[model samples]
Target: MVIHQNFLPLASSGLPVGKIYLGYLFIRPVHNPETPFKMDVSFIKHWKKRTTLEVGHRGMGNSYTKCAVARENSIHSLNKASERGADYVEFDVQLTKDKIPVIFHDFHVMVSVAKRSPEKDVHQIAVKDLKLDQLRLLHLDHVQHHSNTPLNEQVIKVTGENDEAEDLRPFPTLIEALQNVSTDVGFNVEIKFPMVQEDGINECENYFEHNEFLDRILKDVFLHGGKRRIVFSSFDPDICTMVATKQNKYPVLFLCCGANTRHQVYQDERTRTSLTAVNFAAGCGILGVNFHSEDVLRDHSPITKAKQLGLISFVWGDELNDKTNVEFMKKTVGVDGVIYDRIGETELRSSVFMLEKAKKNELFSKKIPSPVQTPRAGSVHFLNDQPKIPGLNLSQSVNQPHHEWPISSSSRRRSPTVTTEAEKYFAASHGLIQLNQGYLPQQLTTAREV
Candidate 1:
């Protein structure tokens, strides 16, 4: 025995329906299927499986198609990622010559100038070589895909150029960028290091020694903790080691790049496989490895290997960094998190975490399970090939248009004119509104006045 929700206005004559939800009515079949109980579907809708984990790499990520947005490390990108329902945002951080840490991608940045500073124009300049105020004079040049940037903007660019330093892209200090973001999103900061140093004794000279650099950034991160968040990472084992040892429990990740990547090879190499990288990180007390996706497509065996070794895994880059690839990684590859350039693409990934959080919250609540017969009358259950109860499970699906139900020839012939109070009631409801075409609400004049 089952009951319908109060909202449904059942014809109440020939039908033996259990409940009527939006576009759906659960009806008891003339021939019951099991235990003298059976239900028939009145609606068909698409159902989602479960939530996915979404992450933002270097911020919202680059716009692969459009040139409108290209900066992955900029504040605009981070905010865009937040709007896309990302659980966290990832970027890079490095210490400058003056010992100030800033959010940037590479050890060296390209600045374009038509005439000024021609000696070192359009070349990769070490971030430490420039002071904060001087760095602010350049604008971003490689914002995904674009051209030369103005100095006033000071935005970091990633475009390849051969121009002299007349007008260059400006790079931002980490503190300056953090001042403008929200605390809700987590930050994965990877420290950029050069292949080799200039001096032996001053090997730690221009660069803030690992510990000094880590602490200074930590101070800045905590100061903005009320409005921003921070997690540290680096490709250099020493850098991650320095940070993790200082705080024993703060989140830290080890970044792994392919041996032959960046068009160059490291003089002092770490390992051939990223799985070994994660193992190395664990040995150093680092949290986990942020792996490149090329590792996944080539053979995702390392991911499982990392898991077996008891380390958290996060996938990054164009391979597993996109929407489809991330989904595949979670559904097939089974990583704890994913890092990407676009928040929209990663929304599904973040959903995984959201759903888990929601299910956990339900455990603490005192409630009775609903019966399977009616949605509101009982607990929620998934019955195959049937209509769903409205407002029961609000999956985060977009407004996907569906085809209208086709009318059979017999039903079409029997169609009657709308003569019921239903049409009149809608007309009366419209009449109550003081409608306006543009902005202001207008008062309607009576028919007599017209």
Candidate 2:
């Protein structure tokens, strides 16, 4: 048996506060105690058999050409994704002219003006040319014409004509996003690197150095990311190499747009084929490759080759908007995970699929191992004194001093009879004062009065 312990601080609640000791034990079953187990040879395909994680694309979903309530890449949309129960939230991160990293998807945004002049008010402006302050003052007109869609149909009215730039939804800084988002959910941060044009010309005249760009994001992640898991991905191979070489904190994934993708076709070696992408990722010691869904649908050979090379595989594209293709990728194609625009809908569908399979297995009396909650016995004492709560596997319990006990689990389980008494004892011992709501010890919060 293997056990892991997490230490967590108690949240603010109605009950009185004192010294709290909590331990969260995760118990795993082992086949053999002495022998070393063989590694999983199937690579990421094994994850497909288990639960398929739902990743929110641009927080819930982004529709630049269509009307949307909460603006894409806003803090509100990020919170909405968390509320909808997304396993991971993916967002684009780019650098401004002033060297500030912000969360935005498009390379440029259209600014609306009250009066039209010869300056071509509808011209698309690059995000890198303007500072954060200048970008904030402009009105965003998120509209783009699709091949099959009409020009007028692409207009999405996001804000009022006279609204100030600050009043509109401004891009969120990297620090703000890292600090404000939920701690439980993971983040898939895509580092935006402009590509060379198909005619072998640079798209942007000036940009940040490769090392400087990668370091800026790394600084924010190390300082504010806390314990949240982060996976770094980018279309530029140089960015992947830099991330892998610079830091070992997070895993790096190479995002590819193969030959069949509708995305801008490039003459570069890496983006032209899926095979090259897998080879490049494996050579650079990258964790995986996020292939365009169209490429995977055309040929699953790249996925199989990646598995053989011990690399993870993921798929994303507009083709995944269809429900049938999502199922096909999960069940037939056997990818590790799929990124979709609609997070809640995909999560619900996957749950239903699992439920149906479980029902079929139940008819044959197949045994399934499900996680059973251990009773609430969360105080710290010496080894001789065990917790009074029943149903605890003391024999398998590994002794650890600091462990995080979930407040949610504590609420569900039976309460400790000594909870109030313990609080009072600690409060008296520490000379704590009764605050507005409850008795708070000086060590808890930094507030002056409470």
Candidate 3:
């Protein structure tokens, strides 16, 4: 499948601090992972480029809304993501009883009240049921009810009163987050709309009408975003459609739970599978689908299908915490972007890839051996599985770069090669190799094998 993208820049150079820009994208039908591949159908047209964008999930990091220092979705957490050089700081935005949008994660948060009698009563209150002032006066020290931990164990509040400890602050309004976060960093606004009941019962109460909810938030973003790059997303297909149709100022991304989505109470038919999301987003003229990592890794046909339809693709899940999983997403699955918890660590690992590229470049400049010349740009190759190493195969080359030579743990043998300055550095760095003039380094010999 041929995948392409036209990057619609949010602003000339930097984010418009109080404004948002939305663009259009298309998606094609994705088949099962095990299905045979087929040609892609024509979709939308714009520009065609492939680049990986990084988004920080719920600020720099979160342990299920319990970040180590800053409260998840708080202003402090958002700022930390920006400081760590994330292209976008993603957070959940929900409404209060007064129709105000606040940066919060869960639908129902535990509320605690301590009275003069030293007796405290706790209740699991839906965020939409409380006025902004009432919500503000109550500290956000409780966990989501889905945590399964007892209510008593969930109320551990940040007790210190330091400026950096802004986790102690009450939940922040959407306007506050927009006004305070850095102008250069973008925002991935995940709108938290409640789901429907399985038995056809109305699951939510005291909530603003869908149109009103969308309108209020759009007005706030227009007034405060100031050309900021805003990518609106939601789990609800209807909400995604509303955002896509209501305005053209920002892109809409459909967030899918996919096959391995855990702890879900109810499932919407439109978003039951990644394939459904691909079709739904395309029909709605939405830009992309942010799938869970399990969905993509299990069967990357969706990524291919999305690309064929001229749609942008993104992945987010706990699996992204491992750098290996992240590399696989970028190198093998070929996603447009990934949202992970450890933004700093992921970015650092990405830099290591750059370092490897630099090393390859240095080797090429020094006229390294023929078996391992720098593979063409945007091309990835793997070492042949044969017992004997074979030279490069120009015919097998593809657009993905770096034909990797993995040292298999089961293989205790080494391939011999002529030594150069690059080999000398490799030997010195690993301390397993001994370099000699015009001779293969010890690191390249069998002596270093386990």
Per-residue lDDT value at 329 in model 1: 83
- Consecutive 10-residue window with the lowest summed lDDT within model 3: 10-19
Backbone N/Cα/C clashes per model: 35, 5, 23
Ranking by TM-score: 3, 2, 1
Off by over 4 Å in 2: 1-50, 66-69, 113-120, 143-168, 346-450
Report the C-alpha lDDT of model 3 over 1-450, residue by residue, as the tens digit. 333442122212231211232532222222212222432422222223436767788886774554444566777777776676677789998888888998777777666777777667777778899888877666655555456777866775522243444443556898988888876677889998777534443345546666667777877886788866788899877677667655555788899887764636334666677887788778767888999898788888877888788788889988887889888998888887789885775344332223445788898789645685543322222222333336642234422232334343445423224245554444343333333322222323465572
Could you give the candidate ranking by lDDT, starting with the highest?
3, 2, 1
**Best-fitting candidate, measured by lDDT?**
3
Q: lDDT per prediction?
A: 0.53, 0.64, 0.65
lDDT of model 2 at residue 147?
47
Q: What would the per-residue lDDT of candidate 2 be over residues 129-153, giving only the tens digit for each residue?
A: 7688777666666557334654334
User: How well does candidate 3 score on lDDT at residue 310?
Assistant: 72
| Regions of candidate 3 where Cα sits further than 4 Å from its true position | 1-50, 63-69, 115-119, 158-170, 197-203, 346-450
Lowest-lDDT window of 10 residues in candidate 2?
10-19
| Cα lDDT of model 1 by residue, 156-233, tens digit | 445324463312222455665666555556566777754341121212234544445566776666555543335577
Q: How accurate locally is residue 54 in candidate 2, as Cα lDDT from 0 to 100?
A: 62
